[model samples]
Target: MAANSPEGATPRESRSWTLRLRRAIDQHLPMGHLLPDRQPYYVGSWVYVFGVITIAALAWVIVSGVVLSFMGPQWWHDSRLGRFVNSLHFWSVQLFFIFMVLHLWGQYFMAGWRHGRAATWMIGVVIFAVSILTAFTGYLTQQNFDAQFIAINAKDAMNSAGIGAFFNVLNFGQMYGLHVMLLPIGITFLVVAHIVMVRARGVVKPIDAEGARS
Candidate 1:
């Protein structure tokens, strides 16, 4: 049959990720508005620096978390090296959230969401909330009695609110996967997307004329 017609054309193959991404941009970015030649007028010294620092803190959290996770919960609690590494991971998490909050607050103080950017800001806020919830879940995933005790206590709070009937924080399998994989993936993607939007739009100007100029 003509050499099987070159494997039946292989269904013409789907578009690549880059091509698909470009197509999506073309669809949504309004053409020329996708990029601007002129620099953003409001970028005063270190106006955009917090975004970079926040991202780096997030990176540290993920890298250290991955290494610590491999040490296993038993190793983490039992061995000195594992404990130190685990502690580093924990503190990095704290720093990640701290930096993220500061970064968002800085943007807010500058009124950075004024120019058709509210949707992006909302996404960033949601990511922040999710990250906090994920951190709580991380504490619940420790497998130690402390995790169980905290889970039970929180379950009481959640039960009073009527949600614990659905979610069992004591479920280590679910909590671990959600904390390590799901939340990290969601947070990282949202952070990266938020950053891309910020870069494309530039930091917002200050309200006062002199501040904007500076």
Candidate 2:
């Protein structure tokens, strides 16, 4: 018998890198919890579906945006296939924002920040703000009269906030870079972080209507 073991005892398994990673996953996101076969009956409300629907819309937006990017702005404006993809991207944005707003309202009215979930709620708020900025940059990349009008008007607001010189809303190159790269990266980070936090904390429970009326 080894000095580290007592008589008739089984040897303990060493914590290898793969074992450590698996342990971390179990601790943070156990399989049953991450992919549950069932949920609390309170989760049956239609309101709960809005968040997932928003995510679906966001996915389609990204897919269509990718296609449009590969085709270029000129192709999107002039070609039939490009216009269809552009329309898909545009409609996806509208759906994403609409459902996102609904989700926000639902959470707000439910007092979703309660019970140590403030961090989750705060992350959701930040995601909303970042999404708005991402959409604004998308508008600036339109390369049309609408884009021009938005840029010229938005530049004044940016200047008043003391960032227009650098941000340069009227500069298509800068806006395009932000729309396709910087802002998307930021939004992606926020969304991933928010989802992880949500999974960790679980969904907020419904509050009492009687308590509210009182």
Candidate 3:
């Protein structure tokens, strides 16, 4: 037995990378903080619920978008059931933006970035920007005259900005790939990170009544 090894422990077990990774996770994000039974009293406010509502709306958007993708463009543009699902996807995206804006404004007013939460706030801002691009790509993928008009205008704008080479707005395959795959994955990852940071740091406290008046 090696002197550094624990009693009856194998050398590989004592030097396992998985054990080190687990320790790092536990140190940074303990289960207790990750899933607390109770939150701050201020969390009971109606404003706090907007973030959760935004997340729920995003869930619907992803689900409907997946269904639309599997059904393909012809069915979604022609068939009644496919149109219904496409409508669901469209409306859910609207709701997502609506609630996300509400949540963003609510957080801004509350100074949500205070107390080491600046990273969390910044992550949310990135999510918002990425979502805008995702929505724009979705518009470009519509396969209609409207899509063509938007794409032409967007191409002009991109060319003006010197990014048309990389981001060709007229390419339906590129837009569809981004709208359906890359952007969603980025948004989901950012949202998960935002939530984890929020859970780890706990909710921001309500502003003092006196401070508001001042």
Stretches of candidate 1 off by over 4 Å are 1-42, 208-214
lDDT to native, each model: 0.73, 0.81, 0.87
- Top TM-score model: 3
Give each model's clash number: 0, 0, 0
lDDT of 2 by residue, 1-214 (tens): 0122222322343335455555556666687767667776778888888888999999999899888877776889888888889999999999999999999998888798876688888989999998999999999989899999999999999999999979999888888888887887887788887777677657766775232332
1-214: candidate 1 lDDT, tens digit per residue: 0112222223343235555455555544434544656655656557467777878888888887888777665788888888888888888888887778887888788777776678678878898898888889899988778898999889888788887777777678878888888888888888777766765555565565454232
Model 3 misses residue 117 by how many Å?
A: 0.2
Write the number of the candidate with greater TM-score, choosing between 2 and 3.
3
In angstroms, the error of model 2 at 115 is: 1.6
| Model 2 lDDT on a 0 to 1 scale | 0.81
Query: On a 0 to 100 scale, what is the lDDT of residue 109 in model 3?
Result: 94
- TM-scores of the models, in the order given: 0.76, 0.85, 0.87
Instruction: Go through the candidates in order and give the C-alpha RMSD of each one to the true structure.
Output: 9.2, 7.3, 6.5
lDDT for 76 in candidate 3 is 87
